[model samples]
Each structure stands twice: as C-alpha cells, then as structure tokens.
Target: MIEALIVGAGVSGLSCGIRLREAGIAAQIWARDMPARSTSSVAAAVWYPYKAYPEHLVIGWARTTYDELMVLRHDPASGIHVRNGHEIFPWQVDEPWWSGAVPSYRRITPAELPAGYRDGYVFEAPVIEMPIYLDYLRQRFEALGGTIEPRTLASLDQALGASDLVVHCSGLGARLLAADSTVFPIRGQIVRVTQVALDTFVLDDYGPSGMAYIVPRSSDCILGGTADEGMEDMAPDLSTAEAIQARCRALEPRLGAAVVLEHKVGLRPGRPTVRLEREQLAGGKLLIHNYGHGGAGVTLSWGCAADVARLIAQA
Candidate 1:
C-alpha cells in the first residue's frame, strides 16, 4: 500500500490525511503531542479568513473545507455550527473587501449597538470549538486507518526514513527540518472567558492594523493579541494577556468582569509566502512541504492540502 507520513497534526496535516485517504492512499499523521496541541489548534477557529493568504490554491481550499464543514454544522458530534457574527470596524472596508462571503455583512445602525460604539457589521458563518473539532478530526482519521504517533523529530533525515512520502505540515517545525529560515514564529496570546452572553462572534478591526477578534465558542469566548516575530512560548504573559482583555473589553463593555476561563498562547508559523511545494530528498524520499500558514491554518488547510496533493501526484 502506498503510504505517506504527515508531520504536525494540525488542520493542514489532517487535511492532507483526509485528501490522501479519499484518493485511496494510506497515510498517517505524526506529531510531538496530540494533534490539538498544534499551534493551529490555538486558533479561535473562525471560518472567514481575511488577509490570511492570497494564493489561489489556498483560497480555494478554505472555501472547499468551509463548505464541507457547513454540512456537518447541524450534527451535534461535528463541533461546528453557524451563528450570527459581527465585525466592528472603525471605518468601512472597501466594497471589494466585502466579497459577499461574510454572510449579510453590513453596517449596523446606531439603534443596533450599545452606547459608546460607533458602528459594526453582522454576518452568518461557522464557528469552531477547536478542542471538539480536533477530536472529531482525530476520530475520522483513526476510523479511516490513519495512524497518529507522537514523536519529537529533530531532522529531515528522521522524516525521510519514516514513510514512503512525507507531507511536512510541521508548521514552525519546518524551519529546522526544511532549512527554511524564512519561516518564523508570530506569537499570539488569548484570554478565554466564560461569557454565556456572547452568543455571537465579534470580529474586531483593531489591534496592530486589525488582527484581533473576540470569538465565542461553546464554553468560552477568546480574546486575542497578535505579537508577531517572537520566540515560541506557550505560557501566557500577564502584560500581553491584559492587553488582549483590554482590547476585547472595548468590544463588549456589557460582559463586564467575566470569569477568565483560561489564558493560553501559541506561536503562528509565518513565511514570506505559504510554502506548498514538493521536493525529492537526498535519499530519493518524496517530500511535500506544507507549512507557513501563519494565522490562517484552519482557513487555508484544504486549499493548501489540495495543492500539496496535486504537486505530489504530478511528481
């Protein structure tokens, strides 16, 4: 049986497994920890990916995956559902910016907002409880006979010898293995709060030219801070955590003093461009590199994975 080894069990890695399985290929997803421990899993897991990537393949993949996810939204086991969402902008984005994918995205009237808020927009989209969603993906992968093993791999030689073909979804791990210095870590911290009142997701157009959003999943709402180009540190910094809270509070003064469910941080893998190319290693090992997603792993997974799969097939 043809087999592939996928490093980093994040969205891209699992998507690679899914596509390969559908194509009648045998694959396994290997990671240092559980797949959910990946940096992509830290994502708020909102569906619409603004400024994530412009790659034609990546964009198409996101749309395909999101469409498929929409189907499973009604299934309680799926961990996905459509909720009314909001994006509060201090100013309007260009008309072309709307692209009509933001589900009824429009400026809110003064009557619709609480006092002190100028304007906002509303839309309908899928929100991901990533903890649950990752579990769902793992079940599907395992059911398909895709094996997952946790091993700390330090070199490409280790990966080259492990499987017939390797899909490097290693995210930041690609830097050392792929010898890709262009890929670096973009740190992000978030404070999760239990806000039952936060029924909808709020996309905030603020925080360093607008990279932050308050996402309400099942049990907790996530407030984010994007600290790009930082060393990888999973532990949360109180200063950064406070800034995230302050930014989110501006979005919702109503949810005052919400309990801090948790505070977590992760480093997003960033490259000048998302690398989705395949190469033959020194030992004639098949290698398809698929990392550098930055903050859009969930958003770009299927699109990027499809392209990675095609690149392999063509080879």
Candidate 2:
C-alpha cells in the first residue's frame, strides 16, 4: 500500500490529505501546530485570488476551487457562504484576468461606487469563516481514515523515513525546508469585531489608506489588513489594527460601534507563482511540493490538492 505524509496542517495540507485518502492512498498529516493556529486561520479567506500570479494556471485552479466552494456553501457545516461583495478600484481598468472564475461578476454602477473610488465590480464568492472551516476540514479528514500527528520536521528529508511519499504543504516553512529563496512572507493583520448589520464583503485594494476589506461572518466580522512584504513579525501591531478599523469604517460607518474582539497576524507565503511539482528524493521516495499560494491558499486549496493527487497517480 502506498503511504503519504503531508507536512502541514493548514488548509492546503488538510485538503491534500483528504484528496489523497479519497484516492485510496494511506495518508496522514504531520504539522508543527494545530490547524487553528496555522496562518490559514488568520486569513479573510474569501474565494478570490489575491497576489497570486501567472494568469492562465491561476484561473483554472481558482475556477475549480470556486465551483467546489459553491458546493460546500450549501452544507452549513462546511462554513462556506456565497456572499456578495464589491472589489473597488481607484481607477478604471480592464476586466480582471480571473473575472471568469466567479459565478456572478459585473461592473458596479455609478451609485454603487463608494466615495473616492473610480470604479468597481460586484461578485458573489464564497466567504469562508476560517475557524469553522478549518475545524470542518479537520473532522472531514479524520473521518476519511486520515490521521494528523503534531510533529515538527527539522528538514524535509526527515519525512522520507516514515512514508513512501511526502507532500510538502508547509507554507512559509517551505522557505527553510525546500531551500526555495523565492518564498517570502507577506505579513497580514486583521481585526475581528462583533458582528454588525453588514451582509456584504467589501474589498478596496486601492484605497488611499491602504488595502482594506470587510468580511462578515455569522457571529463576527473580519476587518483587514496590511500587505507588508518580507515582514516576519507574527505579533499583532496595535497601530496597524487601528488603521485597519479606520479604513474599514470608512467603507461602512456602521462598523463604528462594533466591539473589538481580537487581532491576528499571519505571514502569507508570497511567491512569484505557486510551486506544485514533483521531485524524486535521494532515498528513492517521491516528494510533491505544493506551497506558495499566498493569499489564495484557501482560494486554490482544492484544485491544488486534486492536482497533487494526479501527480502521485501518474508517478
């Protein structure tokens, strides 16, 4: 029997384990921390690709993930909801390269444009409540005869002794494990506040103040964030949190009175492009590398996992 070891417990790693198990491979996940503590948990996690590149490939993965997410949205336990939102821009531009990925997408009307924004587009995409979604994934993976062990690897080579194959879903940890210099951190911070009356997500990437977005969940809403590239600080900066609130409040003043809940910071694994290729290890075992989705880790999760399964099958 073929056995596999996935090296991270984040959305990417869990999704990979589920796919591999579904393919009848004996798969287990090994992580340094629990899924809830992963950087994935800190994401606004909307099913839209942000800061990931190489148009053609990204769109295919994003589109596949979008279809899957829409299906998951119907299952309340999945913690995915198809939410309507607008992506406002400071100036008019060409239709987004990945616009076709979403089920519904259109230009915003003059009245719909927010104050000070030149143009915008409205679309309905899955907004994942990370905590609930991660828990759902963990449960689903375990139910599929998958196991998760909390073990940190000093190097990628360490997993070779335990399994016939290794799937690297280590996110930023890949920088050290894979010795990939292109992998770096895009530090992001978000503020979770008590729920307001807002039902829609607002993403204003070109706001004068910086990139700001509001993602409303059932119990609370996530307001974010900063995209400080190469920043390794995991601790939340109070000033950045306040600035995020100010920007989000500018989008919807109703957020003014929302009580502060918590702040989170995560290092998004920023890379020029995602790496999802296979390699042969020194000891005759197989290794599939699937890291560097950046902010699209959740957006591209399922598609990447499916691809990894395909690669393994062909091997």
Residues 179-236, candidate 1: write the lDDT tens digits. 8888888888888888757777777655343455778777778887665675777778
Cand. 2 TM to true fold? 0.98
lDDT of 2: 0.91
Tell me the spans in candidate 2 whose CA falls farther than 4 Å from its real position. Answer: none
Residue 121, model 1: Cα distance from true site in angstroms:
4.0
Taking the tens digit of each residue's C-alpha lDDT, what string does model 2 give over 92-126?
Answer: 87898889988699998879877888888999999
- How big is the positional error of residue 290 in model 1, measured in Å on the Cα after superposition? 1.0
lDDT for 81 in candidate 1 is 71
Could you tell me every candidate's TM-score relative to the true structure? 0.89, 0.98
